[model samples]
Target: MGNKLNQGWLYTDRINAKVVGQTVLDFYSQRYGHSDRQVWQERIELGQIAVDGKTVNPSYPLQAGQTLTYWRSPWAEPDVPLTLPVLYQDEDLWAIDKPVGLPVLPGGDFVYHTVLEQLKIQFPQESLFPLHRLGTGTSGLLLLGRSALGRRELSRQFRENLCRKIYRTLIGPCSLSEQFDCHQAIGKIPYPQLGYIYAATADGKSAHSYGRILARSPEKPGWK
Candidate 1:
């Protein structure tokens, strides 16, 4: 609302960092000596700010073990007319329902046309932290973290196999009950034959997939 004040403070060696925001009126009033702590009926909502590491309330009074960050936001950045649809949020993560065809980050040939640029334009003051990748053709939930602490917590979840993932695909089929597990050696196919690492094997990355017939269309007779 007003000039965004971005400041950081650390209360203790083991604590995390935090931020404060001001609405349009209070930002200008702070230039003078402690005139009055600008209060937002809401944004002044002080809280401990770390992604995965800790939890704190805005009025925690900044103990000796905490840190703070500030951004004196001047109000002139052009508004981004478009916005990202946020699906879920908490101290540790932002989950978004991504649309198909949008790449997750900046890269060759994309530059200003990417999701990172759009988000930066939308929330001009807060730094965005993106973790993980999704192909441009894929659409689903994307997870993001706000601070180093949060990143650590999410990384632990990834390492401990605590995350749940599921995917679906539509492919034409030929059998009524086409189900079988093909277990075999996936060594390189000799010379020209084409092949790939397949099924549940003792090597390669571990992944599991399951599929069943959902709907059969009258337009496709072989699907039965």
Candidate 2:
């Protein structure tokens, strides 16, 4: 199979107060770290970086409230499953069976090879937005909003904790009770590779989950 490629993309960001005085090269190199300083300089020289709609040099100083736009060239993105099955649909909502290995939105190395872009191509006449998100490695039913009013209402439902969410997973053999409640707090922590990642910590936000054993495999000593 042939790999999918996006034509091009425009990445936009606003200069915040913390990094207002930094130059374009310093800002991009220190904050993003996706490209080396030399590559960023080359892109800047090629007019790929813009400030407030005007092309700027690498030494251009950024100011608070100014818009920064990066014209990213087209590139080959990682291949992923493109099939999206509709489990349910209504005038205001849609439930899609999202396959594993497919990213819910564009980020990192993925631009056009994303569920959001695919949905836009499939429903060109409609304005649809995901109500929530699922990880790239996760396969589950994803909910979407069909209209502005629908989005607002559904977002409120999630904020008020009215919607129920359940997840099933397979794990290695272990001893466990019939039912259990895990209250592990999760928050962002600095890492060596990525800037930061979410993990369990004492000073994190409260997170709770309830799990129950449905079945046990005698041969493998696994539970579900």
Candidate 3:
């Protein structure tokens, strides 16, 4: 794969009163060198413009002190290692331990280099449908439905919250007890430089998590 060159965000600070009531298209045209309004207009349609940490319309009102972010399209896709281990497989479904760095589906600069594409290649005979998605940063078990019946049943279970997942991870010393349940709301907030926002919020969808301190690290102040 060729080296990725086209990935990043362009930022601008709204310090002066020069752009108070101007539309995003008008402001970019005046402030930036690109005189073609159509270009900026197209980028806005592609979800490339954000104000303060949220994507909004091109005509969004800009307030002083708010930050503007623009996503720059990459020139090429970067290389990502694709290594998935099948934990269980049958006529109905396959449980796969997906490796980190492989996207579950096409997004950003990835298209063919994704878990979906890889599974299609490996299980040419089975028509696989992903049950859920995990971020590229996480390596975990992914359930894939193999047939129409399997897809419908698994999807129904997930929708009704009948499925439970246990995640094991290492974390720093905690104030939490040996066992505790955390109820936190999950939502989306603007990512620092990335084009899209990520899940994190003070108040959002209801979520419950149970954690237990399995073991404490002997050398460092950490727990598993």
Candidate 4:
């Protein structure tokens, strides 16, 4: 229905059966009961939604049937993250602590605020492999695998590096020569997603990064 004070309707089993196929602040927080991510973050800032018509994704995955439209939002409300924090899970694996800006699933603009829909709302019954890839801001340890021999033993321990990785980077204001060696040839610049580190001239490809500068530096945010 026209103008922004708004109202429109449509859903397969015939209209007005109590808002079909869901949405429109999940039928206004289930007719005022809230929670469905509290009306999907209150209609995503009140622009009042639009699915088949476009502008969708407040987790957008509603389709055992389709159709959703909205235009209801009196004011502010956004920080609708109900939960996610499982430092470890069993039956074959599930680790967490991926904070820093979060994103271990759902690409680009970040669908449903990632970490695989918060581990599918905590193991919605299966499938959760995710071996490695932590750089959405880069925080710490994360490895998930749940059966199938724990995803083939953590995918053969991250493809044979035997997994004992330790990282703690944050360096600058260097004075060099503390046993230096970064003989490089890093690659990746195709479909896109950053990766570089040169100096193996005559076209590079085999990267190497082995260092040990345990401590040293003399400025602010310094080093130790």
On TM-score, the leading prediction is 2
lDDT of candidates 1 onward, in order: 0.47, 0.83, 0.74, 0.57
Candidate of highest lDDT = 2
RMSD of each: 18.9, 3.2, 9.7, 18.6
Off by over 4 Å in 3: 2-74, 121-125, 192-198, 218-224
Q: lDDT tens digits, residues 150-181, model 2?
A: 89999999889998788887766669888999
After superposition of all CA atoms, the RMSD between model 2 and the true structure is 3.2
Location of the lowest summed lDDT over 10 successive residues in candidate 4: 189-198
8-119 per-residue lDDT for model 4 (tens digits): 3222222254455565445445543323565556565554666656666554545534445654433221222424567878899888677665656543234345566657
Listed in order, each prediction's TM-score against the native is 0.44, 0.86, 0.62, 0.24
Per residue, candidate 3 scores C-alpha lDDT tens digits across 1-224 of 35756444365556357778777777776665433688888887788888876887778777777788877755565577776788998888889998877778765456556788778777787788789887777789999999788899999998998998777777765677899988887775543222233465886688888999988764554432
Stretches of model 4 off by over 4 angstroms after superposition:
1-97, 100-138, 155-161, 171-211, 214-216, 222-224
TM-score of 3: 0.62
TM-score of 1: 0.44
Report model 4's TM-score to 2 decimal places: 0.24
> Which is better, 3 or 4, measured by lDDT?
3
Better of 1 and 3 by TM-score: 3
Screening candidate 3 with a backbone cut-off below 3 angstroms (N, C-alpha, C), the clashing residue pairs are 6-74, 6-75
**lDDT, residue 77, model 2:** 74
